[model samples]
Target chain A: MKYSKQEYLDYVDKKSPDSPIWKNVLIAFLVGGAICTIGQGFSEFYKNVVGLSEENVKTAVPITMVFLGALFTGLDLYNKLAKHAGAGTLVPITGFANAIVSPAMEFKREGWVLGLAAKMFTIAGPVLVYGINSSIIVGLIYYLIQKL
Target chain B: MNKKLGKQTIRFANGINILSYASIAGQKEGEGPLAKYYDKVLEDAEWGEDTWEKTESKMQKSAVSRAVEKAEIDIKDIEYLFAGDLLNQCISSTFGLRDFGVPFLGVYGACSTMAETLGLASSMIDGGFANTAVAVTSSHFCTAERQYRFPLEYGGQRPPTAQWTVTGSGSMVLTRQGNGPYITHFTAGKIIDAGVADANNMGAAMAPAAADTLATHFRDTEKIPQDYDLILTGDLGKVGKSIAIDLLAEEGFDMSENYNDCGCMVFDIDKQDMHAGGSGCGCGAITLCGYIMDMFRAEKIKNLLFVGTGALLSPTSTMQGESIPCVAHAIAISAKGE
Candidate 1:
């Protein structure tokens, strides 16, 4: 009843905070690249020294990284790392593990079944639901293409 | 002043006085800009409590007790206490002040609870119902997140739209006669839903209600934004702040010069990693009780409009895909004898 919507929009545009693009991008890149390099190192060790098949190495690398991530999260060290590393810590598989364990640990006070078990998946729940759904759709499409 | 302005606005004839107030914050909030303004800052979020919930209760208790102490009043002299929080059953307030032995009024306006308590407490003082009243509210980041969003340890990434719940508490002592900011008028808000369903974007959900209340206040009082030295909305972080600014402009009040959102102003968004900004009952309560009240006392600000906005949605409601219903209450405060 006072001013027009256009006028309000302009005010908002002027007031929003500007992100530090160069700094964020540089950190994200360095952190993301570093995580990938570590993952690659694990893969190389599994492939050459462990004498594992390529398929087995592919699975082992992520599993190892995820285990480390979850372990750091359990120790409450991952959050501190994320705080300083910014998106660097978030770019790796460790971030996913941290995400799952953080909320679960936060809710442990409400009891095991309702608190921990239920909330353990709060953030990851949507990701899993959509991941599975889309995978099913992709698998069906692959099947159709193969048949054709 | 006219006691009643319109359907929702009320003006106090005998201006209710703010005798004293206190603010207490957890570690994160203590690191913010208004850090120096608070009465106490907890070294840890738990404040020596066993659970985060209990910690929040202790925060509320400390805030009120400190305010009462600052006001130089005994607990028994306080006629009533008004308090609330973002907890189920309002347990934070109930248990926090159970030992105070003051007649209590539990309010739940989500983040807007600070304004709600002040508005109601002011009315009671103006109506001569009580000689002295205390208004307090609190919120803890760990407890609110666990109750409304997810578990504390959940490493789930918060989107930029998500706001950090402020871990703090604020309390105010209002008396029939005192020297401080005067509770001049207030415009009660309506529950407004712009059909926003995303719980993560609380600011966006609560903006419409804030806009509605501000416009109503302006209309009822026949006043413009320039009438007040400052105009603030509670916890409409960066995102909601923008929305409210635009809405107020549309209502023909250009507040760009003197307006700010408590949520956005409390934290350094880029440096603090506070995504959008701060949200919670404590965000508004601490800002008003600590920052704004100090301004009034020092004569830095003469008159101001503080609109406390809230998103009334439980985790259950949001989980059921229900839209967030929001409300904002606007109270006009002026420097004493103004």
Candidate 2:
């Protein structure tokens, strides 16, 4: 290491205390808490207000979470929040939102170049890759079952 | 008194044509601070290329075409055309010159295309390869966004290192005639990447590049801040511009007075609502074409230093966890009475 542990610590201590770390943590709390509260509210709605099955609501939760993330991400509010919070706004379902929105946002600025064109797939890229692969496997299993 | 032994060399712009420049962005119909959004300008323009491209080409053609008209020289009168843009293929500039009907030589220099292209054209002229040429470049938020940002349709988060796209273009006609404009000096730049930054804010992303170019220009020309009528930097914005001045000052160069940043000068900082004001290659180019031309034509300012800055990162680089690498080029444009 270039600097000793004590030296590194001293350097960091002298560094500005106003780093994004604390704000990022707060963003995690605020966004995470908000999402969690929404989950609880959804569960309650299914359990009491809607009389829906728990399994069904559980399945629907991720979709709603993604939708909320997308909406906030679209409004430019989420991005501004993201600037201050960094990964805090990005780690959860918001990450999925960011994945989709970020690429599109970049491309939107690009016009129709490969950057923008490629961005269309950026946000949902992982979901499609994993989901398609799993579905293909599931379909093969179903086909074998029918043949057997 | 000592005079340098270097011989004079001049290049002319030739075979330059404007094929057609088209793109759009920004808010559609609103006046005020919110319109300061780079995307809003593109969205408002409601076309393809970002504000930087649209603004740059329009201004470029506006002046160049006029100069063409003033000199009574047809587009074909230009033998070598030197041009560039803040784009991947230099499309904004290539397409900008598409309709003018002349040969095109693509040039690339972040924001210093005006000077960079002029330097090239002058070399060609001095070499007797061409007689007249036009050096042009255009920048737009829409085109730049796609190249540097996200698709116009997709929403993305930007780091502070990213800068708002500018909306303008600039072009100049370089001729063999002594009565026309000429490039007085040229200084190349070195790539500088200081790793402490967020990628979304371009001013920070390009600060090091600006510093390097500015420092080199002063050193190479042996000129101080007060030597030029105006010392301008291309698209440094508020943050990068300040950093450039500070960095130069560290080396005993105080450029606050005779120095100006293109990003800071174009739009009203108070009214434009841009966090850092104007930017992109178009920022300086348009200012030069629109205002600087008038000043130069009238012989108001002489021995001006124009430094253009650029961040050399593609979107792929950022997505791949690469930090931004930046470069800048400086050109000195002057009109000494012949």
Q: For residues B225-304, what per-residue lDDT tens digits would candidate 2 score against the true structure?
A: 88888888878777677766766887788888888876676666656445556677767666666556566656788667
Q: Please state the error at residue B143 of candidate 2 in Å.
A: 2.8
Give lDDT per model, in order: 0.86, 0.62
Q: Which candidate leads the pack in DockQ?
A: 1
RMSD of each: 3.8, 7.9
**Per-residue lDDT of B1-338 in model 1, one digit per residue for the tens?**
45788779998876789899999988888889999999998999777877988999999999999999998889999999999999999999999999999999999999999999999999988888999999999999988877776555444446567899999999999998876578888799999877777787788778889999998899898999999999999999988988887777877889789999989978888899899999999999899988888888788999999999999999889889998899999989988534
Tens-digit lDDT track for model 1 on A1-148?
A: 3435455335444544445667766867787788789999999999999999999998999999999889988987787666546678875788888878887788778899998898788777777899899999999999999999
* Candidate 1 regions with alpha-carbon error over 4 angstroms: A1-37, A50-63, A77-96, A112-114, A123-148
- Residue A82, model 1, lDDT: 67
Among all candidates shown, the one with the greatest lDDT: 1
Candidate 2: list runs displaced more than 4 Å: A1-42, A68-95, A101-119, A124-148, B1-43, B48-73, B126-129, B151-161, B178-182, B190-216, B267-273, B276-278, B295-300, B315-326
